[model samples]
Target: MSKDLRESEAASLDNEVLSLLGRHVSVRKFRPDPVSEEQLEAIIQAAQMASTSSNVQAYSVIAVTDPALKSELAALAGNQAYVAECPVFLVWCADLYRLREAAKPHLGGAATYEDSAENFIIATVDTALAAQNAAVAAESLGLGIVYIGGLRNKIAEVAERLGLPELVYPLFGMCLGYPDQSPALRPRLPLPAVLHRDRYDAGETVRQVKAYDATMSEYLRKRTGGAKDTPWSAIMADRLAEPIRLHMKDFLQGKGFLRR
Candidate 1:
């Protein structure tokens, strides 16, 4: 293709991708309709295509459709009603169990690094990447999704409920179904705040964040009808001050991860 043609095609592709990504919003309220099996299959296929560390693909996804199981999982996720109401609750796991099994015969009882921090990071990153791809695919298919990090509130219970063996743990859950409510798109920090060039620029980042605080304050004011207008920085400060998910380290260790 000619240079101009190639640039035009690239821009066209960008627009298509950005159109879906830019309008992203978490859909908490879902309709009663169920997501079809075909759609679920396609979404998972897209998820599997995500990049993995050394092509190890150290991730597994569990689709919870049974009402009883979903109800129990919903309770485990801190009573997140959407977990039960949504047609499908997908539990994304950082799985080293499969890798361990596959390597066992080859290694002949050799010492393994699966319990090392590096492998843990790899598995977590791989799981996140795959889940994001699945999320985008579901959006494209007109299905709504909301990530349920609350699943970690009782992470051990969740793992036991899901029958996860050693070297595997539930990283997060996703609720998927048709939308019942259309929430406003939340604004994000300016690109300059996150995108650094060759080196980190702390001053530029601080400046951008201050500007974002004002933007978020206004957005919150409107969203809450003047009931609340807390600045983003203050909200984040409160978050940092709180002891959130303090058991994650212990839980991961118990699951035979991050030993080194």
Candidate 2:
């Protein structure tokens, strides 16, 4: 590549990364092309490079390529067919079980003492950061990815299917493959609504959200052939309004994560 071409490529790569920042859209449709082994290796390496709290590295990733497992996972995750169809389904876990077991001697035969909310928080954060890095890397490689937060909807069932031990929580699942369809970028909260200077400013939050609702509604209509006219706020409110809300406390207790 010539110097000018190199410079142009560098600028384009920068734009690609930034585009991922805002233009990132969850791709549910994917081509039949399998993600290459080299690409998968690079993505995992990027994930491992993510910072961990106190270097504890409290995270584990399970790559599911087995058709049976993917089908089970898809059913457990609210029948998300894409999870089964995608070439790769990565399950990211907030894992402290290994460390907790490893520190058994330090706990004087009561390793249970080390299991606390603070530990859970650290593991979850570490896992989330690592997973986001993997997602970004996959995006950079001309691949499509979607976060399956629904994986937590039935935590116990998912854990049982995967045969997970205690102290290990499934944070989320990720679907990865080549894109068969290109969807428009999902609208985000306007900058002023979320990017506070120092402390959080809620002064114009409501107004900004109202404006965003209008913008997103139009986008949705155009995309969905005027079928669904849902606004962001309404969708969020509905999600928060349920009482039992697909209870997960029992499952979490079983998994040994002391949310208390």
Instruction: Report each candidate's C-alpha RMSD, comma-separated, in the order given.
Output: 2.8, 3.2
What would you estimate as the lDDT of candidate 1?
0.94
How high is the lDDT of residue 129 in model 2?
A: 98
Q: Which candidate leads the pack in TM-score? A: 1
Writing each residue's lDDT as its tens digit, candidate 1 over 170-194 gives 9999999999999999999999999
Residue 152 shift from truth in candidate 1, angstroms: 0.4
The Cα local distance difference test for each model comes to: 0.94, 0.85
The TM-scores, one per candidate, come to 0.95, 0.89
Q: Show the colliding residue pairs in model 2.
A: none
Per-residue lDDT of model 2, residues 72-184, tens digit only: 99998899999998999999999988888777777775536435778878999999999999999998888999999889888778887887888888989999999888888
> How high a TM-score does candidate 2 get?
0.89
lDDT of 2 at 158: 85
Off by over 4 Å in 1: 1-8
Model 1, total clashes: 0
